[model samples]
Target: MNRLSVSRLFHLNNRKLFQALIARYSVDTGSKDYIDGLVKDDNVVVFMKGTADQPRCGFSNAVVQILNFHGVNKFSFHNVLEDESLRQGIKDYSNWPTIPQVFIGGEFIGGCDVMLEMHKNGELIEELNKVGIRSVLLDRIEEEEKK
Candidate 1:
């Protein structure tokens, strides 16, 4: 083959190899069993746009704040922003079309608005209690009542 033909062949082969590598490394890890195991393994699981310490969106931050308010510091979090397939997969898994999905005791709890409402209605405390987590808000309220 001439030099030109050989160079073109090499470029095409490299392009194919690069695409293959991208596809291989970016395989989606958000299957039903994977998500199920993740939620089941942790009493509190948050699928949000960012990490607990640095939430990317307001709703994600709100979810993190709500959990922190209840004294839940230890929980699993998945950053959907980092994974496109997982982002879509989580929505499909919970049948909820929003980020910042909460799971308590392996049950799908709604997004930030639902969390806020539940917090206001005292249902979040109940849900946490079911997962063996005692809301610190309860203690704070009791202390205030004693005052």
Candidate 2:
């Protein structure tokens, strides 16, 4: 076969392999439902790359820091890298293509960039309150100022 034909065949095989893998991980409706439960059951949920205490990536760590800075320590987090089904299932579940996806009160908030922007402009505090979560950071800071 010619070089062009060989390359085309290789690409075709690769595409098929990718599709199969995606089907294996992405078609488990049970996993997707489980993820949905996690999102709705928690007031704050972070679908990041690692655990809350030890994030696996810089972006994930930044998200963890953002939450911690806001005094939201009781939030739920799912490490996408831990389970292949979960990693792909979350993307399908959220219809979002990235990690560090944040959910508040069962609402799909944006990723790290959105979190950073909200935190910067102080809108994050309001968002938290909308979910019945109080930002202790601001209250603590105010208390310190009065001391």
What local distance difference test score does each model get? 0.93, 0.87
Runs in model 1 lying further than 4 Å from the true structure: 1-27
**Local accuracy of candidate 2 as per-residue lDDT tens digits, 40-145:** 9889999889799889999999988999898888888888888777788888888889888999999998899999999999889999999988888789879999
Cα lDDT, model 2, residue 145: 98
Residue 82 Cα positional deviation in candidate 2, in Å, after optimal superposition: 0.8
Each model's total of backbone clashes? 0, 0
Worst 10 residues of 1 by lDDT: 24-33
Please state every model's RMSD to the true fold in angstroms. 8.0, 12.7
Residue 121: error of model 2 in Å? 1.0
Worst 10 residues of 2 by lDDT: 24-33
Encode model 1's per-residue lDDT on 14-113: one tens digit a residue.
9999999998676565778778887897999999998999999999999999999999999999999988888988999999999999999999989999
